[model samples]
Target: MDDGGMPWATARAVGDRGEDLVCTYLEGLGWAVLDRNWRCPDGELDVVARDGEQLVFCEVKTRRSTRFGEPVEAVGRDKAHRLRRLAWAWLEAHGQRGAAFRIDVVGLLSPPDGPPRLTHLQAVA
Candidate 1:
């Protein structure tokens, strides 16, 4: 398979890097990251953090090139719904069911030889 013109391993590495960048960025903003790559039967939540009284569930999308579309464009209605469900599952599992929570999307465009560009969309769902 073409794998979108990048090997699976390379693609995974790009995504991991994006998540790492987002985590550092969030921490720089004084957000405490509670969990990362949190996975359950439903799916995975890339970065889960606490900002003041709100819990943020962030989805990270990264690409080496925006040949198809912007990274944030990947999260459509279905993906948003999945993130919501995953967030709820995370809260229940951690005994924080009643906590104020919101979904966020972090999009990263990492070119072959340049500083990556990041876009954060808060309260997406």
Candidate 2:
């Protein structure tokens, strides 16, 4: 949990837990997770998976509550554009041999009092 500071350790832990859950859910849906927390000079991608013929670059946002806004609301157009660029860089760096590629976002809302809710938005970018 290298969250840059101890104050954010809990947030980091929650995010990590959410990512694990999302990965497991994706696997159950028959998607093979090719990478987790893949990084480059630009930024980091939460997850990359092979869904039959398409390569999916996923951005995951986890939240403990909706006090500010929903998890999906966190990713805006600018972020989506950045994610697309990152995806291209990933494909290029990995040899650009995939069938096709798309950007997706997974929003997780894990409340302390109840079950976590997951929202998978495919082809967001």
Candidate 3:
């Protein structure tokens, strides 16, 4: 994590930084972020938020660079499917039903010496 703008070492740090940035961005857009790193038997969801009347399950992928590809490209069909399942699990655990939900992806590129980039994809599933 970056404390006082100091970067940390490790992939987890990058992810945490990306999530923090995304949360701020979403909040700026009037979305109320609810759960972060929500986990179930299925897997972990990076973020969950309410965009007005809709529930958004967001998966965040972050990288130092795009040498391989954009971070959002890492999420394939399998991952999307799992996110859907996880969304259901979250709803079931919370005893909520008939709620409108959507899957979203937030791709981040945070270089060591420059401003970070963020891409928000809606309805990924």
Top TM-score prediction, candidate number: 1
lDDT of 2 by residue, 1-125 (tens): 22234357788889999999999999999999999998999999999999998999999998888876888888899999999999998998899855489999999998889999999999999
Q: Where does candidate 2 have its weakest 10-residue lDDT segment?
A: 1-10
Better of 1 and 3 by TM-score: 1
Error at 19, model 3, angstroms: 0.5
Between candidates 1 and 2, name the one with more favorable TM-score: 1
Ranking by lDDT: 1, 2, 3
Highest lDDT: which candidate? 1
In model 2, the clashing pairs are none
- Higher-TM-score candidate among 2 and 3? 2
For model 1 the local lDDT of residue 109 reads 88
* Predicted candidate 1 versus true structure: per-residue lDDT over 1-125, tens digit per residue: 11287887887888888899999999999999999999999889999999998999999998878887889988999999999999999999999888899999999888989999999999989
lDDT at position 94, candidate 1: 96
**TM-score of candidate 1 versus the correct structure, residues matched by position:** 0.95
Each prediction's number of clashing residue pairs: 0, 0, 0
lDDT of 1 at 123: 92
Query: Local distance difference test, per candidate?
Result: 0.90, 0.89, 0.88
Write candidate 3's Cα lDDT for 1-125 as tens digits.
Answer: 23234455676777888999999999999999999999887789899999999999999988887776888988999999999999999988878766899999999988899999888899999
